[model samples]
Target chain A: MHASLVVSGLRKVYEGSGRRVEAVRDLTFTVDAGELVCLVGPSGCGKTTLLKCMGGLLTPTSGEVLVGGRRVSGPPPGMAFVFQEYGRSLFPWMRVGANVELPLKQKDLSKARRRELVADALESVGLADAAGAYPWQLSGGMQQRVAIARALAYEPEVLLMDEPFAAVDAQTRADLEDLVRRLWRQRGITILFVTHDIDEAVYLGERVLILSASPTVVQEQLKVDLPQERDQLRTRVAPRFAELRTHVYEQIQAAKRGEPS
Target chain B: MTDIPPEPTRPSAWGSLPLRVLFVFALPALLIAFWWLTSDGSTNVYWPPLRTILRTFPDVWTRARLRADLVPSLLRLLAGYASAAVVGVALGTVIGSYRKVRAVCEPVLEFLRAVPPPVLVPVIMLFAGIGDTMKIVVIASGCVWPILLNTVEGVRAVDSVMSETARSYGITGPARMRAVVLPSASPQIFAGLRQALSIGIILMVISEMFAASNGLGFTIVQFQRGFAIPDMWTGILVLGLLGFLLSVVFQLVERRVLGWYHGLRDSSRRSS
Candidate 1:
């Protein structure tokens, strides 16, 4: 199967005022069409750098990222990113509905079509009544949901989420994880989700790509063999789930200790 | 997980509705009462009694004077203020958005801003002539500085995340500026506008006082020159009233335009 997104030999070095730091070094990965891939790593492992490079928000020092077979030098079309900081990502001045509809205005769609898409997106996120409410008026979890609805409304072929549930409570995080899985299954859109939580990586992703510490590279890729249908209660307590999470956790500990992948 | 948290309610710093109203008007009312009591039947020439000024107010500001003086003055003020707002916002957005432009214009802007605007009335008159244009130009010149400078700062301070979000979604050019940039920078822009309004008023009266046949400032000068002490006092009162009225109107517009801003700030403050 052809890959929908490809990162080849991606390297990003920050050089400023006579100080140099290599954030991401020689990273290579791929996400096939309709695949849900999670990227996990130790803190400061440059997951954000890789994601930004893939999303075309940041240019790689040496190498290339291809989305839909086209090289990404700048933010490419039909791709959306959900930042960890939802408070900053969402425009506070816009209402929940307007925030979702903002990107749709860029597409060549009729007003009725745009309105329909916005309504459907909001409804999917269970925020249909919050259309007129400003983002800050809602709770942290609800605001993040609005951000997701915005990405959904854009009808993106590839969605990139960077630690999207990091700031929410554990219960809300579980609910949002389910929401993501459900949406991915329903829409069949490719997603590259980045996180540092081992259990979350094991739970949400079909395949997990673990990275080494700073000046990072992919340490390992482990596929989940658990049942396809996952629930917060049962799947989490399953013996196989425990085993996979343990392997991921140990790999991350080794990475942090500077063991070569 | 099913229900969202309720919106936080803001604690009122000022108590009940009636008490809040009283708090707002108490000082001004006390001052007015003191003036009325102290100035009752005064024999002073320059400081006429409060009743004499109030009585002369209608006679001095008759319908003819309203049309000939007050109307023209306000029209010039409106034209100058509107022009200043447009030019200030336009130029400020450009200057704020580009680093090179900001660097090149910073020193020149600082120097220009330092020179008191009233001092420029003579220079403006030389170019705009001793007509309404001169008065309008003078007002606009003073008003533009605050609005322009504030706009530049606001534009510079636009949130990076929001800007990146706009770009990632293919929202660019004028659409991005209008939807993302301008709204993000509006709070600072409004602050500048508030400052410019008062500056606009000051420049209006000063320019009229320098050279004009009829205006609030001109009429006040005429009254002083003709020894119409009560009439002069009334003209001053009219100027004060006009400024107060314009400020109230500006506050209403600002509240409407910045409702989201206030709501966001209040919510964040309460949550934190």
Candidate 2:
């Protein structure tokens, strides 16, 4: 159950083409082992860039991301990423089972063991029946599930998701948000999800990190202390939930106004 | 997901089926009909009515020398195309993965592809000898660029996010290419191969026609030299049929390889 991820004074900037744009500035955050933290930010606020830096997909200008107190020189050995564009994220040519099995192949697991893990992952995502199907053969929601299954099958200690459900319809997005909550609670995996949606962040995260406009720094941190199990309707109406959402919403507005909150 | 705009599927409703079928078949049918009308003892050039050409197919097919020529030509095409697939795909993969490799090779390949295969026919015939090897080289060299360029297109076209996703999983080095890059790039790769297949066929006939004393090209030239108009028409018809058949075969394979993508788009369209 030990799955803490620590990001310390991380700074990232894009410097090439003789035009430098700083993306993340002195971003410091820590997710306790098995905690779910949602990052809510404005567009171009570098939330995704921060996640990319944490996931080692982009190099940080300085500082480090540590998984279990070990510095991440590259993608952490036990980490996974789920992207927003599920259609582009999953390999269309691969069957659902094969796509899920891809990251597992890099593991030392035996073929039978890998099959078992893949089955478990797909079943967890309620996609066991689609093991033989290809990603393109599924709906956008289902394609995203295959992507989740791909990450799950990797047995990552930390899962980094960048707007995973943003492409789906409203109903599908709600359903996926619930699915993610279930996994977060059940597995206690360290989850860092980045999204522009405030309600989604309020709904799923145990903690929400509000980021400022581009050249992003942490605007505020709000702990979600609502009931552990959440339903979209009931939770959205909860008094504490409204209070927290309002606070995050105000912070975003302040960031937009370029005012300190 | 991705915001790529999809092409509309051809209407397959009952009313459209015949029209669609007619649309595809119309041009060739009209050409054949025109040939029939003009060559029916009415015109001197473009000799032989369509019927005379059809009648000559069997005689053309069964000739011992024709069998020898056709078999060798077909084998040469297969070998050349296969060689092109291997070398082109491999080189393209490496070039596609490395930016420096792509930059260095892209210009050279673009220039080479512009030069038609016929230009190389004489050079190959001189250096490799006027043998099967020379024709094979001619076809291979001519066809490889399409496959290579397509492979490069396919490989480069692989979504950057997918590669990032793979890298974020600690699936580095060769594993990343096989698992992520290759499958993602496959649709484009298949496109290149299909283009190469047709080019391979065209190069096959043209190379033989240029330098060799063998193959369908040789037969066509032999007919022309002997002033046998119908026989020459028969050779052209056989080549057309062969080209059409190769194209059909590749289409079938393309559908199979990209079946998932095709099915998904259809389903999405239906749902929408």
Candidate 3:
């Protein structure tokens, strides 16, 4: 069964060096079941911190994150997080298949079932042949794909990706974006993707959640009015796509200028 | 920029395997030839002829209970080194993972590490007696520091993201250590093990030298004291060969263990 996520009045304050730096303040948002939502923000705007809080990786100073209506205390069940640093995220010593199959070890699945899932996940990411290869043997984009395959193999109801495509080149980034959308549609998994790139957020998300600079809060929630059946070429060229991209772009620029939303 | 000439390509060292082997052996071969020629018939008290030493090697090694002595020394070395490796890696993981433990134990460990193994032979002899136990203890004490320190460094230096990934995947406790932590720290641990090997060898010799026991070190010292120059040279030569052989075997194991690390490093370097 798929799950949705809701974050309410979330605030995280880092108490270090005898000073408290407010990272995320009063950040409130929701992603409905089977919906793909992107949270876009400027650099150093506490997007990663907020995502960490939502994923239950970090304890918030106040407020709460609800996954499938349950408060998140530790890493929430039925939810997986894909970090931005793919190189650091994947185990270098593990082969591609082993890396993907790691999370499944926690599940009460038979060896055959686990193998099947690993194969399926690798095939989905187009890394079926690279299963025996180590992560370091592959290129950056291929490594990130292995990471995505890892998340996919977990068979989570919700996937939280933090700037997943940011480290790759332009061509690879575009290819990965399409792969994410395809996976989302095929599995009906709720996806909460975070990124600093305005175009990436616009290109991926059905609903783009704009976040302001620190102390961070939701600035705007812009809905993409593009067609359900979308392609990178036709969908991006649509006049509606251009309008939405501009709106998100202007919102980020204004947020950068410290304008109160 | 236009006037700058392109750099010339150096000749590849891998032109031929046989040629490369010959190149590496040329100096040692020449030295051996010189020694053989100079000392063939000379009757120096300390400086035994290479031929005399070579002739005595088979006699000492086969008939003079040298093989029996070799067994005890090898066994002690293996026992001490193995125990050290196990204890070092286990304790290192704990200290490295926890900050409080590291802070508490670091000073005492540092003090112990600073004391050379040879110096402690007398102290160990008094406590353990000049037996197999004492020799093993000396080797273990001497070799543990490198492994422990390297493991601590390796575990501490493990990328936080890797651990976080493991945690996110619900891999924690012993599973986390076995799957993520150990593998990540292996390259460094192997490096520490390499350092420990030579130290173990040195301690093996030192420990035997001090006590009333049978070992290569004891044999060497006995031969020297009795003015058996050829036999002493044979012992020295055998010890040197032993060191060389151990290192070669160790390198083969290390290569297998750290094959992934090397591959990753090479690929990244090539890309960069």
Candidate 4:
């Protein structure tokens, strides 16, 4: 059974240094098993806060996140997070293969089985030959692929990505987006991707959840009706894609202007 | 990744292996040559001729003397250095990991660190007595501060993202410390170790000079008092040679342990 991720009435407030700011005011959403969902918002909309709370990296001030019906007080067993800062997330001291295999060391798998999973994950991410190379030896895009490969090797049921491609160049970002879609289709791993890029959310997800600016709440959830077998060239240029992106873009602008959802 | 040029893992700034070796040895060779020529036949009462000191080297550092002085001195150095390293890293990790521990320990650590370790030789001897225990404790007391302080700084500076990444992946307890904390802190830790090596040698000699018995420092002081000028110079030379040899070994070990760190730094430097 695929594990579905649930976040209900999640609220997070940062309290420190005599200042209290509500980062994620109220967020309620459910990403069905094997489904890909993208969260988009204005720059200060607390998409990261919401994602961190859901991933159990940060404690919510209220409500709860559930993966496969089990409440997450801390990082849940079936979940994995792909940080936006791949350069920091990866251990510079470890080679690509070792970085990928690190998470699996905690699992019940044998050493041979762990190696097999590492190889398969690297092969899937088009980084099979980079196993011996350190993370800094590769390009920014390749480093991110290694990070994704690391998550994949863990065989996690729920993958949470926090604007993973934000630091790469435009061309590399496109390639990574396609890589995510391909991996999602092949593996059927439930993914919750967070980004501020409206077009990226439209191009990648089955559904896009847009968030309001700071002290955030879900502004809207728009269904992406593009055919399942989508590609960069044709799908992006489709009339429906334009309408959907424009709608999401307008909603983000409205959120920035303090308009009610 | 392949498009990137081959990394210059060793510093290639000078170019060519033979030339690099030449550059490394050039200054030391010139200095030694100057010493040999200047101190050739002429001799002061205190400063013997270079040839006299060389001749006395075989006589003064015979197998018997080496066994009595050099071997015990080295063993004590090794024991003290090993203990300092273990305690420094262990205690430093705890202090660095916890704010309350660091807060309580900082003032005391700073006060103790500020006191010159050689001055504590008499104080340590009072407690442990004039024996191997006192010498090892003296070496350890001096050596631990650099290592402990450096480990604390290194552990404190471990990147937050790396910590979060480890935590998210279910790497906890000893696994987390091994896979994440230690490696992250090791570059600084090695720096501390490098500093401690020389300090350990200094303390070794200082502790020996303070009191009774046979050791390299004790032998040197005895030669000086008895006016065996040439033998004294030989003892000084042995200490210098010992320091040089230990340093060479330390570098080899460091190269192996921190190969990845150097590679990472070099690549980052080139990219930026």
Best by DockQ: 1
DockQ of 2: 0.51
Task: Give the chain A TM-score for each candidate.
Answer: 0.98, 0.97, 0.96, 0.97
Chain A only, candidate 2, TM-score: 0.97
Model 1 off-target regions past 4 Å? Answer: B1-11
Error of 1 at A99 (Å): 0.6
Clashing pairs in 4: none
Residue B193 lDDT in candidate 4: 99
Q: Each candidate's chain B TM-score?
A: 0.95, 0.86, 0.91, 0.95
Clashes of 4: 0
* Cα-based lDDT at residue B27, candidate 4: 100
Interface RMSD of each: 1.9, 6.2, 9.5, 2.0
Two-chain DockQ for each candidate model? 0.67, 0.51, 0.40, 0.64
lDDT of 1 at B67: 96
lDDT of 1 by residue, B70-125 (tens): 99999999999999999999999999999999999999999999999999999998
Model 2 spans > 4 angstroms off = A1-3, A258-261, B1-11, B14-34, B42-46, B49-52, B267-272
lDDT of 1 by residue, A50-151 (tens): 888887888889999999899998898979989888999999889888999999998999999999999999899889888888899888889899999999
lDDT of model 1, residue B91: 99
TM-score of every prediction relative to native: 0.97, 0.90, 0.95, 0.97
What global local distance difference test value does model 4 have? 0.91
Give candidate 3 regions above 4 Å deviation.
A1-3, B1-13, B38-41, B63-66
